[model samples]
Target: MRIRIRTKWNNQEREVSLEDTVSVLAFNSWRIGMQSLLEIENENFQTDTQMQRIAVLEEMMAFLVHLLDRIAYSSLNDSDREALVSAFAVKLADHVHDNARDFAKGDHRNNFINKLNIRLVDYSETTWANIAQEPGFSMGLTFGNHIADALGPRDKKWVLDYIQQVLMPEMVKLFKQVLARLGLINNEN
Candidate 1:
């Protein structure tokens, strides 16, 4: 039986047609999108600077979040959770070394000792954890926070209810809420 599922993001409503299995379609869409990323030829090693590497990592994580948004919460089983979590770790391990490339921007020139330092610094199991621990990597953690998905079946109901409700609202209300806390802008405007 085919059914239409409606999802909204950024004030846009999308309707996806399900052919008997919603999870089946979700899995295939994610797989195809990631596969295409791999096919693109990597630029020179020289071009793979720290910023570029972080952007690449963000792209990968963002894709996962997008995938989760599509799939039904009940469909995510223990096996699926394990696979997805491990996928993040494995991808982190693969490209962590890419940061060794010389700085492609700024005045920081490539040096032998700096290159060695990048190699010697062990990233442990969680790069996100490492980033969150330090003040210097604030950008990384802020982005990492948005991209990280730790939701399981237990937390799914409230998230889909409360969090999804927030997304349904207009952006102006959300922007004012953020600004009100910082005291930069006032509601009187």
Candidate 2:
């Protein structure tokens, strides 16, 4: 989803600044992550309870955070990339906390953030498949493991294939489109 930014600067128009763009990207990431979670739920991915649902959503957010970090790597310097991913993760944490607070116990925001940090570190050790330009085999497997854990025993058989083939590819396509529209990346990337 595209975000509109309203700005006023002495009646002179300027391109959306990087800060504003980062905010918009983070917002869109959260929106997209939520949508993805709903889609997965509809597919009967086993988010039967509120805690289960929140766990799935947290996994989705972590995947998105890592994916966004990878996408920004080619286009942004280290500090800028870190800032963008951090902001995106914070926004995701806020959304998760808002949605999960009543159902779950204790510090959802910090919990999600802390888990996200750990996920980022773990996912970082996995390779990025240059040929496919997406998460490598290990990364996708790891994400599948996370989803499977969140989903419990049911649907475990197909989770890995679905995540590696359907989920990750679709998310990459969506994020790339968003970044391209925002001029952070050209269409080719």
The segments of candidate 1 whose C-alpha lies over 4 angstroms from its true place after superposition are 1-56, 59-72, 98-189
For model 2 the TM-score comes to: 0.83
Model 1, residue 152: what's the lDDT? 28
Q: How would you encode candidate 1's per-residue C-alpha lDDT over 13-127 as one tens digit per residue?
A: 4442222123333333323323322322131112123454344333433433322322212345667544543343333333333343343433222232243233223222122
- How would you encode candidate 2's per-residue C-alpha lDDT over 40-149 as one tens digit per residue? 77777777898887888788789878988887887789998888777778777878888898896789999999999889988999989665457888998888888888
Maximum-TM-score candidate: 2
- Backbone clashes (count) for model 1: 0
RMSD of each: 18.2, 3.7
Lowest lDDT sum, 10 consecutive residues, model 1, at 39-48
| lDDT agreement of model 2 with the native | 0.77
Q: Which stretches of candidate 2 lie over 4 Å from their true place?
A: 1-12, 15-19
Worst lDDT window (10 residues) for model 2? 1-10
